[model samples]
Target: MKKLILPFLCIFLLVSCKNETKQGDSNSNELGTAVKDTVIVEVPKVPIEKTIKEIKEALTAKGFKTFEYVDETTKDTILMQQYFMAFLKRSAIKMQNEEESERLQKLHMEHLSKMHELGYADISGPFGDDGDISGVTIYNVPTLKMADSLAKSDPMVQAGRLEIEIHPWWAAKGIGLR
Candidate 1:
């Protein structure tokens, strides 16, 4: 009985030792590579102001509404512009290369004409709806009245083909006009 007990203890110790070694090897294999922590930094934003005193004066002279100004600022104008240019380039490519989609180019040209007629110098990118692409235009016009009038009376706006949003320079910056 003593001899049998001694043999059983030795077998148990050997099996446990083998399992411990296997576990250690597995853990070391998992630790082969060192992990790195990444840090991201964000920069402060700067505001851009556009004064449309001339555009506003022109609108007022045309007997449009009284001028009220709303300032406009966007966090990522460059990104927005890039997106706009990409859309334009893609649309142009599609129009030139694809025969079945001429209407898109036509609608875009019409919208561009409407924007140009209003003396809008800045385009806020294109918004698409039901296969139609419409763009927002920003004018450095002088008065809110003129902006409102142009927004309301423009052919695109009247036909519900375009949307117009007016913001005074101060309003864009959340500041009050003096």
Candidate 2:
């Protein structure tokens, strides 16, 4: 997150030069005419193409792996983006009481919901069987480090009830399950 903010902050500081003149302040000219304080702010006009380019550029800037492929049937360009699959596994710690366990479970669900709401996770679900791997979450983040951090931020993982194993995965940029 800091990586995302610093660069934009620097650019904003550089481009955002504002005149120090106040509203009521009037600096007289050589002729003693009243000079009104004026400030210039240029709002950029972005077209659709430029927006698309910026999205691609941002993805690349974030160290995301992406590629475009021409579909044979429709001859349309398809963007394939890399995602991370987090395997939520069982941890050694299981000492929580019933009430505490219930609370942690609720918090865990809330965390997952927030991740989905924030577009950080594409999909997440638990496994049916009682196995070492408990659940899986597909993270729609740019880098493995980001996915790892988000996964570690899960309440269950932080409580030592679950462990995380992540791997790089890929899919169509805008494709959804049927």
lDDT of each: 0.47, 0.88
In candidate 2, what residue range of length 10 has the lowest lDDT sum?
A: 17-26
| TM of each candidate vs. truth | 0.28, 0.66
Off by over 4 Å in 2: 1-55
lDDT per residue as tens, model 2, 1-178: 9998999998877665332222223565555555767568987696435443566678899788888788999997777889999999999999999999999999999999999999999899999999999999999898899999999999999999999999999888777999
* Residues 1-178 of candidate 1: C-alpha lDDT, one tens digit per residue: 9999999999999999877666664334454533346457976586554445554455458543443433356442221111011121112232233443455446655755675665543443566653434455454455566556654554434444444555553223223346
Going through the candidates in order, what is the number of backbone clashes in each? 19, 0
Scored by Cα lDDT, where does model 1 land?
A: 0.47
Native-to-model Cα distance after best TM-score fit, residue 168 in candidate 2, in Å:
0.6
> Candidate 2 — number of clashing residue pairs?
0
Measured by lDDT, the strongest candidate is: 2
TM-score of 1: 0.28
